[model samples]
Target: MRNNKEVNAVQATKTADYCLAIIRGRYPSLAPAEQKAAFFILEHPESAAEMTSVQLAAAAGVSESTVVKCCQRLGFTGFSQLKLALVRELATSREGAFGEVEPGDDVPTICDKIFTATLQAVEDTAKVLDPCEVALAAEAIFKARRIFFFGVGSSAVVAQDAQLKFMRIGMTAHSYLDTHAQLTQAALLAPDDAAVVITYSGRTREATDVIELARECGA
Candidate 1:
């Protein structure tokens, strides 16, 4: 229940930049339809920012509700709010050069430009990532006696990645891919335990169910 009352122009820019970073990190975990919506947002952000849910859905080859749901998964209230955030980003961004590359420019030149742009984006993300957030998350990890991570499909891969990272650091962590196994593990967690549910779209029913189970089990 975070509010945007304290968000100014700079904070808005940071939020937009962080949104892009999250999209990059989480894209592989999204469904095919959801990924299509994500690409539409990134590839044509200006146009997508101005679009209504229906218009965005048509452009992304998805349902209007699906487009709206994607926005929600990204922590937006709805399409209008998400669109406003993107528009703010467009306002702060530098304009690209108008000229198209000639055929003689070579593939390497194009590759270099793309790589440089991505590097710049990563740098921008680094500027906005809150050190305090990571510290708090670390504290949460340290305080919890047992940790359960849940994901499905590609998100399952991310869950396993987190599990391995924690285990290597000499922490207690478990990742579950199957619903039944997830329930069993969740039931074993005590009140002092915690669960990290990783779902890019946040609409995966099986994963959500596991989260609910963990909550009920006092995790």
Candidate 2:
């Protein structure tokens, strides 16, 4: 029979992966206190290892009860369990939360690293995306009378690419980088139109305004 230590070892690995997945997928839906705790754990995982629940709660500007409750919501029994899983995961992860561009890297090395990072990102995204959700989105696009691609910065590039893909399929599609043009276009949209806003990081307040405008216009 497997020993207690062996069972715990397995649980630890699963806990780390599971907790991170929950944080990523359910963060926006979490309460403000829980969101604070979750973001604290994500942004300062190493610090979390050394801090007690009270300390972490203070740092996150939440109560100790909130810390424990957040852990429970994240699928752990309590704060200590959550911390153990997070610390274990952080210990094993080599890459920081974001992608890194190292200094003194040669052109070929940079290219190789960038390509590898991109592949890893796509793989990670695929793991999180539900096939059913993709099917629903595809069906919605198919039935739309018109489509608008809305985004800015790197997400803008993604929006433009989507515009191109729909255009190639002979669909009526539009994407504008200019704020005025985007507002004007959105204002002209009707209930028959649809807007697809792509913001991977979920940090696009300006793009959100455009979407709100489109929504108000009955798009």
Question: Best lDDT goes to which candidate?
Answer: 2
Q: Model 1, which residues run further than 4 Å from truth?
A: 1-41, 46-84, 95-133
Clashing pairs in 2: none
Candidate 1 local lDDT, 1-219, one digit each (tens) = 234564354455555555555555555567678877877887677778778889889999999888877776666678887777677666877423222356777898877767766775576558576665668667777999987788888998899999999999898998977767876786677878878888866778887787777778777
Point out the worst 10-residue segment of candidate 2 by lDDT: 92-101
Task: Report the lDDT tens digits of candidate 2 across residue range 36-86.
Answer: 988887667788878999999999999999989888776678988877777
Worst 10 residues of 1 by lDDT: 93-102
* TM-score of model number 2: 0.60
Estimated TM-score for each candidate: 0.57, 0.60
Error of 1 at 7 (Å): 11
